[model samples]
Target: MINEVILDDFSLKVTSFEQGVSTSSSGTEAKTIRFDFEVRGGTEYHDVTVHLYKNTFDVKVPELDLSFRGTINNYSTSRTDFTNENSSSLFRLELIEIG
Candidate 1:
């Protein structure tokens, strides 16, 4: 199974992953990557979310031997705040290649 993706400067362990192609209205196609990852600490959750807010990143999925300049097409988290100790959050992210 594919378990990791390097997004910008952070290496994340993915719980699940998917890869596909997306077609635009003009019949152009682009690569798409989606994954689910969990952050087990409040500080970590804060860090990951900060990275997610950036406009674009260099993404690499080593198991698939794929790399691209991508942006977040979709993103979601199980919770809003992770201030408490021992907190954990499940995050789903979908990225589409733009370069």
Candidate 2:
């Protein structure tokens, strides 16, 4: 479980989280983190979109004690239930450690 995720000036309430590292054919490795969040009731979709872009934000995971300035490699969204108005967004973030 991710204890907390801080992105720029906002703290997100994540529903689910996953993180891992992968190596490419050239043997280069990269870290990735993904989280799922729901936007319902009073939240505005535009507000969330404003904070996400190709490579425009910083990320921090407190429980993992990890900090990285990274990019949004992939993102997807879907409705939680077709019978309701609730929706969820999934964000996949690729991280690069700063020295």
Candidate 3:
């Protein structure tokens, strides 16, 4: 699990994080990391979009002592159920490492 993720000048305290690696028959390998977290009190959608628009960015996971140069392969956000008024906006980010 990753406790924190640093993307360029922005830092997020992630609620949950997962990382995976896969290899194809041709020996090509891919490294990916996914993060699940929330943003509160502001327009999180706009803020996140601006930072992730870059072709590539550096990600640092302090808990794993790992750094990756990656691209944003996928991203999604969903508002919390209406019943849970206290819940914050949930966001998911998936990044694939580049060669």
Cα shift from native, residue 87, model 1 (Å): 1.4
Q: Say which prediction, candidate 2 or candidate 3, comes out ahead on lDDT.
A: 3
Name the runs in model 1 displaced over 4 angstroms.
Answer: none
lDDT of each: 0.88, 0.63, 0.78
- Candidate 3 yields a Cα-based lDDT of 0.78
Assess the local accuracy of residue 44 in candidate 2 as a C-alpha lDDT between 0 and 100.
Answer: 49
Q: What ordering of candidates by TM-score runs from best to worst?
A: 1, 3, 2
RMSD of each: 1.1, 4.1, 3.7
Best by TM-score: 1
* Total clashes in model 3, counting residue pairs 3 or more apart in sequence or in different chains: 0
Query: Which tens-of-lDDT digit does each residue in 1-99 have in candidate 1?
Result: 999999987899999999999999988999999999998667787788787778589999999889999999998888776888588888899999995
Residue-wise C-alpha lDDT for candidate 2, range 1-99, written one tens digit per residue:
774677766677777888877676777876677777765422445566566653545788888887776566667766433233364444444444322
For candidate 1, which ten residues in a row score worst on lDDT? 40-49
